[model samples]
Target chain A: MFDAEKFIDQQVKKVRDEVEGRAIIAASGGVDSTVCAAIVSRAIGDRLLAVYVDTGFMRKGETANVDKMLGRLGVNHMVVDASDEYFDALKGVTDPERKRKVIGEKFIRVFEREAKKFDAGYLVQGTIAPDWIESGGGLRDTIKSHHNVGGLPADMHLKLVEPLRDLYKDEVRKVARALKIEVAEKQPFPGPALAIRVMGEPTRESVAIVREACAVTEDEIEKAAAAGEMKLPWQYFAVLLPVRSVGVQGDIRAYGFTIAVRAVDSVDAMSAVYSKIPHDVLERISTRITNTMKEKVNRVVYDITDKPPATIEWE
Target chain B: MVIDNGGQWTHREWRVLRDLGAESEIVPNTTPLENIKADGLVLSGGSPRVGLNAEAMGKCGEYIDKSGVPVIGICAGHQFMAAHLGGKAGPSKVPEFGKTLVSIDDEDDLFKGLPPTIVAWESHNDEVTELPPDFVPLAHSDNCAIQAMKHKTKPLYGLQFHPEVEHTDNGYEMFQAFIDVCQAHKKE
Candidate 1:
């Protein structure tokens, strides 16, 4: 009874009307945002500006990766080096909500500035159903504030437009597939990026530590998945806890912060079960995180907490 | 001791306390009064408007009444102290959300080396309009009348402003005063 083609066509048409003139879409190089950019490109053609803000909290080579992917999609895009701005804004602010809000507002401010440069009136986001649902509106307790949803400021100037607002993660993947976006099977990344993954104040140094750890986690997990050891997870990353603990590194007492690897499989982000990553893969990730950043991070741990008791993000 | 009122400030306060050379741990609001054992207690700011079934308020009141230890309450903790001692906490005429300055009323152990007026971060909808019989108002601000208060005879203190926040001027000094109180109590 699920008609994928019909739904895509109808949704595309609806969004086309919703975003009439010039608009800018947030394309993070992830499947959801990429797919959204593609759909909006088809709807308004040159009127859609895909703006990507490099928050400096992203994973390794994320900015270049996004640039290449957006180029391949033939979407009109601009990459803003807002890393210094993001770093300056987040300095000495440790609260998770504050971080998310700052990042969210920063993202909007970046896009808004880009929109001004392009004379665009609409801001397109890849926000889905679970974002607003979990963010909690009327009669709903806030589970967590999604940077794209609840974290947005009340007085944002741009006219809002979310084409994929009602769709789930899987549904967005389907749309991505229908649109032939290469990142259709890509794992979900939080809109706030690596800022939320760092438990305390998200400084450039802390983000660097988490970025490398996250890379190692993804590489090890993917290697295991490729070897048919386990199914690829829906989403996975590494979190850097603020506290430093005592640990031994190569017969020396090494005191460093702990890195937590989180992987989960889910149809919708509303609920998720922890991925059963093999012991070998976890070992590889732990070894790589510690070996790569021995001075900054000496201990590595895997998070097995489910969605109900714990959110996907440690923050 | 870090009072975990299930707010973002609870964790930050613990981090700051730990950074200041104090071994701190976050205990849930439901933790019993008898189980708490620390050199001092921090009444962290949180959304105390959420149901009081956690009994954190009751336990905190009992701890302050019996422990005779140095206690520093921030924001909601400040309101809780006022409410516990038969003072009133009504809605603020103008809620302070970000940065504001508090004028110190008298030279006390709390504001020992600090200036007469210090900038501090504030985020609360409720504030104490009146103090208990034995409570002394040590500071005041434009919107918040009782910016700081302390028990006349006890080592207990309360602050309407968040000293843990970096925006607060002389926040670290305020924290140092609380730690000094803790140290002084230990010596006694």
Candidate 2:
């Protein structure tokens, strides 16, 4: 039998010894990072510093939510107002790899500066098994690089310590639940945040458009799930496509970008099946995204393609 | 902020700018330049050498002539800057790509806090062979002699090699120097 408790206990011990001194963690308030932060805080106590960089690529209310979650976890944390910096860094970048690499390097640089301020030597990440696996080093074909893994620069200064590096999403959540973390049931969010979700160059305006769209998707889907309309999928969000389309809004011709709502069920990030969202729920999502971001996003789309044929993220 | 030209090191340039404590943003070549607001501007390197209609190029010219913000053009941007300033730029005699050594001609604000004859990431088919009479060469590689140049008096500069990529050992230092120039200009 695969004993999750035993595994978590052993992993916690290993992390405790590995991160011998003061360490700084990139806490994104996601289940993985939240769980990792909890385990590491239990192991290292006050020696761990949880640093959250508000890259302005976060989902709607994400920064506030993260602050609340971190407060609840009783983890020592600091939030840096790096939205302007991130928006600036991502300006004019269109390629997915380049965006990931830039975001990854920017993360390290920010963490490095924070680490210096905190006088910490170790950098803790919520990197899971699939991150490195998909980031592709050896014989593995290059899947997309996870900003936390493959996007790392070769000349990184701080030493890395990833506690959840070997666990999958399900396993990490299990550990989170075991540790009594509040976000144990929370959906997964990529470390690169909305930057990758926004195709082409991730400008602040584009990111804002996607953020509202994603929030609407999540809200409607969750409302549908809660009302017993359908089962909530493991992951669901909106992707802002690079191309623009013509549409009618209140009998007026409008040309704006299309927003793709994707919901998927998966055990690990290696593969996923598209969620069979109820048509009414999808309707609500489509209606909400267009209504909320009517100016920027005029068209709403539902991604029915499964993982084998298509990845959750269009990029 | 730096603009990605679809080249590999555009992201690195963005990171360097952020690291130097300057707020940055990346806009696509198609993004209207008027929408971007920064104390200064950095034109990052990339492939498919910047086109004349590239919204960024038009904006760069506008910023230099009107905005009066300090601007640093890298590779494609350098070519565009030269072309915009009435200088001629096209294909180089020999294309320079990958690691190449560069020699600094004289101590300038751009090369501040960096060693001479430094290695930088070079990936471009086009090079600025001639400079506008108002601009002067500051650094050069053997194949592409006009590796780095700046306006004789204006707060404008250009580099043929990518200082954002790791191939350039002192690339970050160069960025830091540029940011310093911007800061000085802000004070002025």
Candidate 3:
């Protein structure tokens, strides 16, 4: 068990002592970022500026929801509407590595501009241990390029300060709960957001399909957990496959994209076993997905592959 | 000490020990047995090939053969441990990749005070079909027969399922058991 209070106090002082000047942090409202925001706020209350960028790739109503969260925490925050910027940069990009890199570069540019406005000299991120481990270095193999680690720009101007870099997803949640943050149990969302969830070139249409499928998946899964049908997974989401499959819809041959619902249980993000969701709960997710997005997504599949062969994220 | 077989929960195993007040580090199997100095050794789970790849497993064989330290092999590490000891293991006919109910067929120091049946977490394509010489079976799941095994006299053990993961009930207790075994040997 992690002594979260001791860890928090040590980290608060560490961040305070390390950062000589004002710092700007990327606050994505996920557990990692939100926890980091809360901790840094405790360290240097007014000096820390939490920047929540509204990338068009975010989940539905995320920016607005996060805005309310930051308000409750009493942290000084700035919201940047850079969805247009991200869309332009990610045009014609299909490769997972390329997408992450583009998003990272775009984020840095936005953060750099915001840092200038706040006169902040350091950039703090909620980057945990798994972000860099899977990102690969030394003898480690690169599973995937996490936007924060693999996607960082070479010529970044601001100095970096990552307090939570050594902790894992589970430990971060413990700290979040210790700090009384509401998003403590929030599922792990990639820094690149829904862009990676859409395997192919993330267009407006493709992203829209995944966004809704993901919403339905979460809705059904949460309902199942609430009703005592099944335990909640550590992380669960819907991934939009690059290829389409053939299916019949009311006597008409309909070809639509396939959505793979991935849920896994893990103490940390390093390795995970696929969650054994009840058959009834799976049927509900499949039915609701096909019914809601009838034209866009006709086929619903469950990813039973574990983390070794297949990462939590499909990409 | 934890042998890094490139397993995903290699860190978690180490964390469990650290949280339990055990001093441990994730050391690669390539490190010579003489270079390793520790009370216990945790052989961690790794890639699909670790179940079959010798080079990927590095010098794990020598460590188990040379060192008399108490060892607990998990997942791929468990498969390799069986294979090194003249047991048979290959692609499982009914591969288990998620949480499964495991029944403790026999009890020893490892399963002390634990329930007879446990919901253990597993993620592997291969399973140990036979036990090595003198290593008796301790646990079994619906799909895998050699879910847990113990060497007759030595302080060596293997777990087909991953106890380092959260889903497995009594995971921490098992680690503490192995840790206690190591502590006893340290005094010996």
Which one wins on lDDT? 3
* Model 3 residue pairs with clashes: B7-B45
Q: What is the lDDT of residue A64 in candidate 2?
A: 92
* Two-chain DockQ for model 1: 0.01
- Order candidates by DockQ, high to low: 3, 1, 2
- What lDDT score goes with residue A14 in model 2? 86
Report the lDDT tens digits of candidate 3 across residue range A1-315: 578999999999999899877999999999999999999989999999999998888888888999999999889998999988888888899999899889988888899999999999999999997888677754456778888888888999999889898788889989999999999989888989899999888888888889998889999999999999999999999999977899998899999989999999877865678899999999999999998898888998999887655678887
Q: TM-score (0 to 1) for chain A, all models?
A: 0.97, 0.97, 0.97
Q: What is candidate 2's TM-score against the reference? A: 0.62
Model 1: per-residue Cα lDDT at residue A230: 93
Instruction: Answer with 2 or 3, whichever has the higher TM-score.
Output: 3
Across A273-304, the per-residue lDDT of candidate 2 in tens digits comes to: 68899898988888877887888888888888
Name the top DockQ candidate: 3
Q: Is candidate 1 or candidate 3 better by TM-score?
A: 3
Please give the lDDT score for candidate 3.
0.87
Candidate 3 positional error at A198, Å: 1.8
DockQ of each: 0.01, 0.01, 0.21
lDDT of 3 by residue, B46-142 (tens): 7665767767888888888888789888987888899999998889989886668999998799999999999887778888888999999999987
- What ordering of candidates by TM-score runs from best to worst? 3, 1, 2
In candidate 2, which residue ranges exceed 4 Å CA deviation?
Answer: B1-188
lDDT of 1 by residue, A1-315 (tens): 234576678867977878767999987898878888888888789998899888888889889998988998999998988889999999999988888888888888888888998998999898886677567653235667888998788888899888777666777787877778899998888888898999988888888888999989999889889999999998999999987999998899989999999998766664456898989889999988898899999888888876544667777
